[model samples]
Target: MEPGTARIAVDLLGGDDAPAVVVDGALRAVRADPDLHLLLVGPTEVAAAVTDALTPVQRARITVRPVHAAAGPAHHAPRADSTVRAAVAAVRDGTADALVSAGSTGATVSAAALGFGRWDDVRHPALVATLPAVSGPVVLLDVGGSLEPRPATLARHALLGAAYAAVAHAVAAPRVGLLSVGTEAGKGDRPRKAADPLLAAATLPCGARYVGLVEGYDLSIGARADVVVTDGFTGNVLLKAIEGAYAMAGGPPEIGGAPRAAALLGVAGTVVVCHGAAEPADVASGIALAAHLWRRRATDRVRALLAGAPAHSSPSDSIDTEVSP
Candidate 1:
């Protein structure tokens, strides 16, 4: 309703906690952003509970699309009438500007790709998350996108990550790095070794340059490389490890901590995927993330940038690796 309003579709059945956590998070996001609108997609009673919590004026911004489907765990492939698909449809039908779901990562990714379509020439859809680093923020990719990305896949992620840092975080001429066991070019496994040369020669948009191999420490400290590239297996493991480390050391730093939510890049629409075990606060943040992405038109810009970026290799050169959502 407001000039900068962002209508986000909430998958009420998505998340480990389901309707309750989703409801609580929707309430939090609506109260936090007056310009934010929500389309609650789930059972009527759940949607009612969300609307009931808001004031009359606030309720005006809420829209409800009652869906009837038993949402299985996140790992369950989406059923035909699942809430996540309904949420995606809302965005595609212009009822919402973005979508946020804590459902199974794979389900969300599949639904999004099928609904929004992957950008032409995109080998795989990438999940990107920004973590608070000692120096600043570090953008990490394939947090759950392509798990066993080949050299070409990593190269593609490098370009996507670089463009994201420049557009979403405003990092200028970002330094890009491939995550490896050591800083030496030949230190990593076969994937890393093979990917190194490909990334070295790839052309990154927005003045970004490849910084060669970066150790895992570089991901947290942010002293080197604005963008850290890795397969989802390593990236996801590293992300949880960093989160655990931060948890052990009192709490996350004030500058903002590792986000539990990640933006699904390479999709045609704005979609934010929260950790399946996301708490209410995490869900709220996911909603906020969706709104921010939609408001900034980050997805469209990233796609446009990818369109202009020179191909590192032909589609045949990359293998479509499946990592968990």
Candidate 2:
């Protein structure tokens, strides 16, 4: 392996078009990065397809862990022996620096939480996505990680987003905002109203400051805030809607389109969750993202930052009743 190499464990059977799309994507990733090493966790035959496509020097960088069981469908929970779980195990066992899966988001999140263990103060792990904006990248949290986050969870996510923006994207003194129906303090439902003051009062890491409430338009324009926090259900719906809007407009902005992948935060190890319907290029991008995070040691830095952030008190009985999109 080359120096500074990043070994990424890939779930070959994690996507809608498993094995085939994965093989193509793995090939693309390996060819694109000289310092990238992939541990394919899936059936032997499927793993062979990827290695067979590579030259002798390239094949030297590929490894395989034969896991026959695939994490099929979002409804079914991931089995202990599932490919996604095996990939997580590889990371836990120090065989891979990071893991990438295009499988069920719940299954991946569950397996990662089990294998890597959650941060002590974090109850609900957040999935953070970065969207290219007019000014710069905007970090949005809970795209699908915590569907019904309590007020405390949202506050915790604010700290996560702030640290992530600084560590992952090099944003200095990121401006953080809570996603609400309007920019006013009194707008939004029960959860938003309750969480607003908590975020404003909370001590954010990386010199981040709470910028009160922001409207939906700020997510793309990113002029108001660098980090946008929201419940998973709404964030997920908004992400897809923006992606669809980009498609309708002929193509995405010159900066880039909506990300089809997101990094899982609050877990002890590096893990990336890709869109279930991810194509080859999207899968390749996910792998690249895993490599990037591992190289930057983002997970460790974010955790360290969170450790220094002050804890906030929230009502345990608080609940959000918003419908999923």
Report, for every candidate in turn, its global Cα lDDT versus the true structure.
0.88, 0.90
Top TM-score: which candidate number? 2
RMSD of each: 2.7, 2.7
Per-model TM values vs. the true structure: 0.94, 0.94
**Poorest 10 consecutive residues of model 1 by lDDT?**
315-324
lDDT by residue for model 2 (1-325), tens: 1247999999999988887888998999999999999999999999999999999999999999999998766666689889999999999999999999998899999899989999877766899999999999999998989888567778888999999999999999999999999997799988888889888888899999999999899999999999999999989999999999999999998999999999999899999999988989989999998998888899999999998877543443344344545
Off by over 4 Å in 2: 1-3, 312-325
Tens digit of lDDT per residue, candidate 1, span 1-325?
Answer: 2249899999998877887888999999999999999999999999999999999999999999989884465566688798989999999999999999998899999889889998987656999999988777899998988677577788889999999999888899999999998997699887888788888878899999999999888987899999999988888888898889889998888887778999999889999999988888999999998998888888999889999987545642744344546
Error of 1 at 131 (Å): 0.3
Superposed Cα deviation of residue 149, candidate 2 (Å): 4.2
